[model samples]
Target chain A: MIRGKVVGRYWATKRIEHIPSGAFLEVESAGGARMVAFDVLGCGEGEDVLIVTGSTAASWLGGGKIPIDALIIGSLDETGKSKSK
Target chain B: MIRGKVVGRYWATKRIEHIPSGAFLEVESAGGARMVAFDVLGCGEGEDVLIVTGSTAASWLGGGKIPIDALIIGSLDETGKSKSK
Candidate 1:
């Protein structure tokens, strides 16, 4: 996985039903590059994060129906442990 | 998944061989919070990202041998798709 931060957020009201509820976000990679991801935890701008992508990530989002590659699966704590259950 | 940024990275020189080659990262949630994760792609500072946690995440990291909960599985692009193959 790649490391990064949440720089901003994006919205698209028009989407599929199986797509579930979430928003697309602008992420700045730890390498100092910018990117985007899907968020369900409502991550605000400027939060540090871990990211996952590809067919595996899309599968985790909801199989091939979602058309989503990047997703926020959990939040971490200072000790490298996930804060959310 | 949780939205956040890659604020920092952590290293543990003494670890199991199965732990793989990577570092722990300090992440701040998109909700303006902080957390930690394992990084494999060498994500630097101030990057946005998405994360996965729990047993499923652990399984993805190294099939229970790595003791890793949070991992950086992929990097995202301007769109919500993965940057790495």
Candidate 2:
């Protein structure tokens, strides 16, 4: 697992059938590594999130095989503090 | 698949049971991103290699579940030119 901030969203009209239903969000780790992650958690921009990579990520959509390599698993609590700023 | 150069090897004595038998190598992409990848193909340091990540990587081991995230799938030909230097 890795911690990152949701930076943006990605839209892909043409996708493989193996891809599950979800939103693709851009995540940037504190170390500046950026990646696009499949999100089922409805994360918004600037929200702190936890990401899972590799097979475990694709496993979220049941035991079926998928090409997805990254996934946003959780949105961190903001403690009532705004993250958009 | 991603292209990278094998930079070094890793030795982990204590590991989880789910881990398969293979060498762990350090790979650095041309973009300067580095990662530890499990290698079944004997790859030497400085060799240009192709890497597979996500479920595809773990699928190499008979399709069983494993926590491995990255793998060295192929070594690129050097045309008899030295890459070790």
Candidate 3:
């Protein structure tokens, strides 16, 4: 998992059929690296988010061979606090 | 896939049980971001390599849920040329 901030939304007309219906968010990690993450949590711009990468992310959509590599798993309650904790 | 150069090897005394046996190489992408990648291709230091991330990398080890995120798939024949092309 990585900590990041949602910068904006990404719009793409063409996508793979296997990709689930969701918003693609542009995120900047704590290290300043930016990437697009698939979001189902309805995160808005400027929100703090928890991101899962790699196979773990691809598996979050219920076990299928999806091309998604990054996923926004949760939105942080506060700047650095999680809702669960 | 991402292009990176193997900079060195990483050593860890302990790791997850599900992790496969292979070399953990330190790689720097073309964008200058450095990361540790699992390698089974016997890539050498300073060699340019092709990398695959996400579930695709985990699937390369025969389809199991592994913690590996980045993997070195192939070592490039030249600086900017692939052996396949």
Candidate 4:
């Protein structure tokens, strides 16, 4: 898992239906590199997060297929530890 | 998927049996970053490959559990295009 900060939201007015609603976010890694990830966890801006990427992300919806390539698996508290189930 | 070069091999004489045999390799991304990835495809050193990560990787064995966090899913040819199914 990569530790990153929730930098902002992604507004895609038109997108594939395979993607679940409210599934986009922009995360900036500790190294300052940013990438868009699907928000499985409802994280707010400035919150630290754990990012799970690749096919693992696409499989989160179980047998159903989704285009998500990265996913926010966990939210981190101020102490940089995961705070949610 | 992230494209990376198979820089080397990882030898762990003692490992969990849940992880398939001959499943570890070292991959270096285009940005010069390196990480260990499980080799689903038989990739050799110097080959460029595609990586899949997260829980998706752990789920590749159907319902069976594995400790893999990253997986090499495809191998690229000399022209920088995927050469394997």
Candidate 5:
């Protein structure tokens, strides 16, 4: 997982149905590249987060297939500690 | 999943044990970024492949937590079609 800050949010009108509502988040990679992530955790803008990419993304939600490729698995606290941990 | 070309192979002697031997691959993303992947499929250098990144990287090995964060799940054919498809 890579550490990044949530830069923005995403609202897709026509998207795959498997994704939960208000699940997309925009995060900037530590190296400055930005990508969309599925927000399994409720992360606000400017919040530091850890993103899980690849097929494990969908599997994190349990079994069955999902159309998601990235997921915000954890949010970071102010001290750079993981809030979920 | 993303499309990439296998640029090289990796052999880590002092790495995590969950990953299989001869599993590390150097893949160049379509956008030109290079990253390492776990080779579930035996992919040769110069082969086109589909990579699954993130936590699902470890999950693709079935159950049990693994240390991998990327996986080469499929090898593409010369026709630009996926060989496993």
Candidate 6:
């Protein structure tokens, strides 16, 4: 899983139902990977987050196929930014 | 799937019971889905990660959507950082 933050959101009103949900986001990691994220979990702009990708994405969606490549699994607090751990 | 990192995390005392979970992370990928992912696998600062987006994210997860799409499936060691891949 990649670690990054939700930079912004992108939305397409006329998208397929099983295609993908929520707004699109930009996540940049310290590892040098900048990825786009799907479904910002109420994630505000400039919030760091985690992301998932690949076949693991199509494992078992509600009897339907989302066709999307990523999903927002959670939200992180300010604990990690401390740099004191 | 988009590539990124767990820039930060979130911990909600009370959520929608099924909207989203874990700490939200930011990830950058070659595919260009700056996405927030779910289920980050013990990722840390400056770690590059892979992300899955859309309905592709909700396959099983005990059988639910957790809403706010995006999931982090795996972790990358230090090999990808060489910037030579």
Ranked by TM-score, the better of candidates 2 and 5 is 2
- At residue B16, candidate 3 shows an lDDT of 24
Which stretches in model 4 have alpha-carbon errors above 4 Å? A79-85, B1-57, B60-85
Task: Give the winner by TM-score: 1 or 3.
Answer: 3
Regarding DockQ, does 1 or 6 come out ahead?
6
The DockQ leader among the candidates is: 6
| Cα lDDT for residue B24, candidate 2 | 68
lDDT of 1 at B66: 42
Q: Score the docking of each candidate (DockQ).
A: 0.05, 0.07, 0.08, 0.07, 0.08, 0.15
Better of 1 and 5 by lDDT: 5
lDDT tens readout by residue for model 6, A1-65 = 44566766666777666764456787766455667767535777877555555544343234346
Model 4 residue B80 lDDT? 43
Candidate 4 lDDT (Cα, whole model)? 0.64
What is the CAPRI rating of model 1's predicted complex? incorrect
lDDT of 5 by residue, A1-85 (tens): 5556789887888766676554688898656789998874567899766565666665555537567767665554444211212
Candidate 3 segments whose C-alpha is farther than 4 A from its true place: A1-52, A57-85, B79-85
Native contact fraction, candidates in order: 0.00, 0.11, 0.13, 0.09, 0.11, 0.13
Model 5 achieves a DockQ score of 0.08
Q: All models: lDDT?
A: 0.62, 0.69, 0.69, 0.64, 0.64, 0.55
Q: Compose the digit string of candidate 1's lDDT tens values, residues A1-85.
A: 5455788887777756666677788987744677787876767787755555555455555464768666654443445433332
Tell me the lDDT of model 3 at A16.
Answer: 64
Misplaced by over 4 Å in model 6 are: A13-17, A59-63, A81-85, B1-85
Sequence-dependent TM-score of model 3? 0.51
The window of 10 residues in a row where model 6 chain B has the poorest summed lDDT is: B12-21
Q: Give the alpha carbon lDDT tens digit for every residue of B1-85 in model 2.
A: 8788877665544332355788766677767666667788888888899898766776776554464667788898766364343
Please name the candidate that would achieve the greatest lDDT relative to the true structure.
3
Could you give the CAPRI-style class of model 2? incorrect
TM-score of 6: 0.47
